[model samples]
Target: MKIQVSTELLDGCVLALLAEKDYYGYAITQRIQQTIPISESTLYPVLRRLHKESWLETYDESFKGRNRRYYRLTKAGTKQLGVIRNDWESYKHNIDWLLKGDNHG
Candidate 1:
């Protein structure tokens, strides 16, 4: 479904990924792309900023002789995700009602 999303949606999507599991950059990028409308070249910056803001933590994982940095939500990040999810759920409900009303009109 093509749901209307705000710019802040990316942050929420990233947090959602962390909620699901720790993800490397590539995995998170793919997951976000699948779930949300990511802006041009915005993924890395968002991840970096989230980490810089202490909302995320990173560690390296090694497999098949290669290592990549994976990200996980911090305690604060989980709290922020909860707040964002609540707000977005309300937004989604309100907008869904609006669109349905428009359809009937």
Candidate 2:
């Protein structure tokens, strides 16, 4: 069964990817595909939203005879990533505890 991925989780993943290096839409989608099952349609809006939020910056580079827009994380994006990481950590901890049937009083 395919599990549903949340929007916040998707945003965090995209931010983390951009944190590593700038990538075009296709490349970002490909990299994300390695770990999660996401499509171009889903990723494009995320990119647009991030850019609109000032968490991401874009620049176009001439590749061969075409232009490719690349995305990079901004200072805000890095900070956002940090927040997401912390949230994920806490969430995972709680879930793990619940799954392991460990109830501490």
Candidate 3:
């Protein structure tokens, strides 16, 4: 079954990927696609938004004589990732509780 991913989650995923290391746009989309169903188009705007928000910084490197823009997480992005992770854990726990009808004490 297909599930919709929230924009906040998408941002988190991107930040988490960048947290590991810097990556170009295509590489970021490919890595995210391995776990989530998303198109390259869906990601570009996210990258742009993150860049505008100052959460991500980009640098261009020549790859095969072509400039590839790579994204690196900024301090703000790392802080945002932490917030997303905490929120996800809470959301997941609530969903699991509702689905399983089990107390997670």
Candidate 4:
């Protein structure tokens, strides 16, 4: 069964990818597709939100006679990534415990 992914998780994933290196929108979407099912329509809004939140910055670069907008994480974005990662870890641990029927509460 396919599980639904949350917007927070999607944002986290995007942030994580940007944490690795600057990438254009298409590249980011393609990388995300490798692990999760997401579309440009969904991703573009997230990118805009992140940019507005000052978590990401963008620049246009010429590549083969075309300008590509690349996104890079700011200091705030890095900090946010850490927060998201910690939350994900905690969430995963709880889910695993429940799924394994190891819940003591």
Whole-model Cα lDDT of every candidate shown, in order: 0.84, 0.95, 0.97, 0.96
Ranking by TM-score: 4, 3, 2, 1
Model 1 score (lDDT): 0.84
Each candidate structure's TM-score, on Cα atoms with residue i matched to residue i, is 0.81, 0.94, 0.95, 0.96
lDDT of 2 by residue, 1-105 (tens): 787889999999999999999999999999999999999999999999999999999999999999999999999999999999999999889989998989776
For this target, which candidate reaches the highest lDDT against the unseen true structure? 3
Instruction: Answer with 1 or 4, whichever has the higher TM-score.
Output: 4
Flag regions of model 3 displaced more than 4 Å. Answer: 103-105
Candidate 2 TM-score to native? 0.94
Kindly report which residue stretches of model 1 are placed more than 4 angstroms away from their true locations once superposed.
Answer: 1-4, 37-40, 102-105
Provide C-alpha RMSD values for all models, in order: 2.9, 1.3, 1.9, 1.0
CA displacement after TM-score superposition, residue 73 of candidate 1 (Å): 0.7
Better structure of 2 and 3 per lDDT: 3
Estimate, for each residue in 1-105, the C-alpha lDDT of model 1 and write its tens digit: 776665577788888889888999987877777756665377888899899978899999897999999999999999989988999999889888887886574
Off by over 4 Å in 4: none
